[model samples]
Target: MRPMLNIAIRIIRNIGNIIIKNYEIQNINSDYNEYNINLFTKKINKNLNNMITKVIYNIYTKNITFLCKKKFFIFKYKKTIWIINPLDGVMNFFKKLPHFSISIAICIKGKTEISLVYDPLKNDLFTAIRGQNAQLNGYKLRCDKYFQKKNLLFALNTSYIFFTKKKNVNLINLFVENLISLRISGSISLDLAYLAANKIDCYLNNNVQNFNYLLAGELIIKESGGLITDFIGNCNYKNSTNILAGNADIIKLVISKIK
Candidate 1:
């Protein structure tokens, strides 16, 4: 394992602890409403970003900058980029469902070199380094979810599924009509993590702009012998508005059926 990856693991675990602790505290409060849920999640996001920046800068201050949204914010320097999503699956978290995670991607020179998605609730840590295979809790992953399965487990955000029916969302409609089995998990990181861990066969994401989730996903999926591509079999997913990801065989079958 690379030394930088070691540091990233520590950071992930540290943040995971914070999430679990806060979640437990919030669970004890029965006055859970939409307003308080939003407030709690937002506050947690801000704290995570601050802690991540502080820790990374304390060591690699001169070599790292953060990629937030569509632009990079260079905090006094630049070389490597870190996209850290403080939290994913806000709805699940609010409903007290244990499906959220903290995702981090380290990109160097426009390429993802290291990735991690840690489920604080389950303590399942998925990680990958460039050129090395992905791992889940120390076991190597290989994108072979179907080896012991009977169905083609396709995953995406549930809200998109609802939008497809109500609003006729074309971006998401392109998938629901053509895919096999459906599994909706709100967190994008978990969708990718599930694919790597053999829990899902494919994941179609409508939004590709979130490097915070997708970049980290890209590294771990590829490392696990999976691939992330646009709807038409193109490898350049970052430039596209959406992405279709799975192992090569599933990807080929999916594209063949899309209009």
Candidate 2:
């Protein structure tokens, strides 16, 4: 419970509360289109970015990059960068699904130090420091190892189908045929959080975007004793990079299958 982390959690929770409140005010119908969704998302994103920028400046006095709705606002001062994603699952939110979250991470020289992902719908907060254990609502978390395919619960994003290669599709098919169950949650941050909490055995996404999960979710998984890497077991997970995450044994088995 460091001072900075405490401040960050408070700010994130407040922003989430605001977003949820505003979301409830909208008369969302099943007829909502992408334009309607984008309008609501932009409103929330702008408010969150502005509020977070002001609050973070008062505490860290460092550089900040707010990535919301694919827009970036950069500020300069110290070397530390606060990577903020105001909302993680805009599509789910539009569909009136309660799977989205707010992700924030403090990175220095491309290395994440403090990470936080808050789900306002569930009032669940997942957090971690660089070398400390990951936590969900202050309870420690750890990834569960599943060596047997029949016992594994794999999580993914259906959006992968839109961005994946043919090889990736084949790999996904292999997983679907082997794993006990598969879930597409529409929220990478929440998916990674569940992976760290052992709610899911593994998480695979070949179409990961930087603003989606790279900043906060990656560090949360690593801190929780989970492994994350590219499809080839390399640690180079940049924007648009493929991702495979799980425990050591599970990661090895997945790599072997995909290869």
Cand. 1 Cα-lDDT:
0.75
Give candidate 1 misplaced runs (Cα > 4 Å). Answer: 27-34, 46-50, 61-77, 145-150, 161-179, 207-209
Tens digit per residue, CA lDDT, model 1, 94-182:
77788898887877777788889999988999999999889999999988734422356788755454354543355345455544577
Which portions of model 2 miss their true places by more than 4 Å? 60-76, 160-166, 169-173, 176-179
**Best model number under lDDT:** 2
Clashes of each: 0, 0
Tens-digit per-residue lDDT, 78-123, candidate 2: 6666666767777777667778988888776767788899999899
